[model samples]
Structures are given as C-alpha cells and as structure tokens.
Target: MNDEQLMRYSRQIMLSELDYDGQVRLTESHALIIGLGGLGSPAALYLAAAGVGTLTLADDDRVDLSNLQRQIAHGEADIDHYKAQSAAESIGAINHHCRTQVITERLQGEALQHAVEHADVVLDCTDRFESRDAINRACVAAGTPLVSGAAIRFSGQLAVFDVRDSAAPCYACLYGDSGDEDQLTCAESGVIAPLVGMIGSYQALEALKLLSGCGTSQKGLSTFDGLSGQWRHFGLGRDPHCPVCQWRR
Candidate 1:
C-alpha cells in the first residue's frame, strides 16, 4: 500500500483482525453487485467508500422518480438515465480511487455467468428470483461466495451462501424452484427506505468479511421485520441431496 492508501484506510487497518495484510486483501479484491435500486445503492456506496478496489455494478433499468425515495446512488437529475451508469457515476464521486464498471444491460445467460466467474465475491442486491437464481447458479458453479439480500414491505432478509465451503448451503437449498414469483419483486409491495439501507449495509459487511478474511459472515437467513421491530436469525445447512452442491461433493 502506498502512503496515501495507508492513510486512506488507516481506520480499517487499525483493527487487529484487519491489519495491513487484510486491508491489502480488500484492496486487491473485486466485487460484482447485480441490481442498482434500493439495495444496490447503499451496498455499492459502502463498498466503494471502504476502498474496495473494484466494483462491477449491473442494472438494466433507467432511474425513475419513484426511485429517489430509496435509491441513493441516483439523484433527481438522473431520472431517465440507465441505473447502472448512474450508479457508477455516484460511486465514482464517492471514491475516485476505487475502480467502477457499469453493465448497463441486463445480466443474463452467458453474460451473467461470465461476470460471476471473475468476481471474488458477488452481491445479489437484485429484486427478482430469476436474477437471484441465475446469480446463485453462477456463484455455485464458480465456487465463489455470494451475499444475498432482499427487502419489501417492512420485511427484509439477508443470507450468505458460500460454495467455497463444501458444507455450506446454496440459495437454492432454502428456496427451491417453486419459490413464488409474487414473493420475489419489490414492485408488488412497497419497501421502507431505511429497511433497504439496513439490509444492504449488512450485505456489504458480509462481502467485506468474506473478502478481507476477517470475521464470520451472516452465512444463513437473517430476517428483520421493521414494522414490528423484531430481528430473527436461523442457521442454514447444506442439503445433503442438494442437486448443485451434491454433484461437487
């Protein structure tokens, strides 16, 4: 690390668990965040501000006025702009030192698979199950760690599925192909602004832990009910018969 880098990340380096080596690991890591709406906004901001070396942000939608309430990565002026491009600009302004790449097109099929193959860690801040499943499949195939989060109508859930650990479960283990489409989108239900922030921040934290080799990640379902102000967590185990992980085993 250069003198400026040392000074820039001195706070993280101060932690005994994240000394120079750990900080360096973070600086050398790359993260791919799919989706740029509510969850992606804070996740990308925190990661960039923390000096994550490179971030690849993907989203196909344009920024809309409705997004202003929660998508902090965009502004009023960004209305009608591609969200991925807008978010890249937002992150660049926050930390010019961090490399940011924008994928303005939807991540699907081979394109999605290719992105995950190159990332050290992938964040599924996306809003739909189809995208979530695609991301999860790629992560599992690549043996990469994934931190997934979701928020809608005062309810939020976060989980880490690490294919790097043979014993850890993939997302498919928790929600099979039968997962209801109605339950996957934020459009059908409204989300509280701070709920997305809280969950997205946790996603960034988990990504950092996995990247820096620091602490244990939220490697299971961590659910929060903001309306009732209740938080609950549950452990997840790999399905011995899980089709994906089982093949590797």
Candidate 2:
C-alpha cells in the first residue's frame, strides 16, 4: 500500500480483524455485482469505498425517476442512463483507485458463467429469480462465494452461499427452480426507502467478510420485516435433490 492508500484506509486497517493483511486481501479481490438497482446500489458503493481492487457491475435497465427513491448510487442526472454505467460513475467518484467495469446487458449463459469464474466473490443483488438462479448455478460451478440479497415492500432477505464449503446451502436449496411470478417487486408492491439500504449494506458486509477472511461465514437465511422492525434467522441445509448444488456433495 502506498502512503496515500494507507491514509485512505487507515480506519479499516486499525481493526484487529482487518489489520493490514486483511486490507491487502481486500485490495487484491475482484467482486462481480449483478444488479445496479435497489440492493446493488449500496453494495457497490460500499465495496468500492472499501477499496475492492475491481468491480464488474451488470444491469440491463436504464435509470428512471422512480429509482431515486431507493437506489442511492444514482442521482437525478442519471435518469435514462444505463444503470451499469451510472453505477460505475458513482463508484469512480467514491474511490478513484477502485477499478470499475460495466455490463449494460442482462448477463446470462456463458457470459455470466465467465464473470463468476473470474470474481473472488459474487453479489446477487438482482431482483429477478431467473437471474438469481443463473448466478447461483455459475457460482456453484466456479466454486466461488455468493452473497445474495432481496427487498420488496417491507420485507428483506439476505444469505451467503459458499460453494467452496460442501455444507453450505445454495440459493436453489431454499427457493428451488420455481418461477418468480408470485414474488412482488418494488415496482409492483412498493418499497420503503431505507429498507433497501439496510439489506444492501449487509450484502456488502458479507462480501467484505468473505473476501478479507475476517469474519465467520454466515451460513443461513436472514429475513427482516421493516414494518415491524424485527429480524429472523434460519439455518440452511443442502437439499438432497437440489439440482444446482446436489452434485457438490
């Protein structure tokens, strides 16, 4: 780390868990964030600020007026811009040293697989179930760790799936291959402004932990009800019939 880097991340380096070595690990890591909306916004921002060496942001949609309500990484000026591009600009503003890459299309098939294979950690901040499934499959195949988060209405969910750990349960183990038609989106049901921030920040926290090896790997589902200000956690186990992770055993 140069003199400027030491000064920039001095606060984080002071921590016992993330002392110089962990901060170095973080600076050597690459994270792939597949979404630039509600959850992806804050996750990317924090990761960039924390000095993740590289970040690849992917999203197919353009920013709209409504996104300003919860997507903190974009501003009014970003309206009509591709979300991946807008987010890259925000990350660059926060940490000039953090390398940023943008994917303006919905990533799938070989493209998504290759992205996951290169990343040290993957964040599934996407809203759609199909995208989440594709990300999970790719991460499992690549033996990478995944940090998944979702928020809609007043409810939010977070989980960490480490394909490197045989005992870890994957996203498919919990939701299976079911279509997400029954799931409600912020566009349909509406979301409280701060709810996305809370969950997205947690996603960043999990990703940092996984990258720096400074904290325990969270191995379950954590759900939050913003309306009631309550949180619940449930341990997850591998599904014997899960097509995505069954072969890992």
Best by TM-score: 2
Cα deviation of 63 in candidate 2 (Å)?
0.4
Write model 2 residue lDDT over 124-219, tens digit each, in one string: 998888888989999999999999999988999999999798888889999998856787788989999999999999999999999999989787
Candidate 1, which segments miss by more than 4 Å at Cα?
A: none
User: What are the Cα lDDT values of the candidates?
Assistant: 0.90, 0.93
Clash count in backbone of candidate 2 = 0
In model 1, the number of clashes is 0
Q: Where does candidate 1 clash, by residue pair?
A: none
Evaluate model 2: give its TM-score.
0.98
Best by lDDT: 2
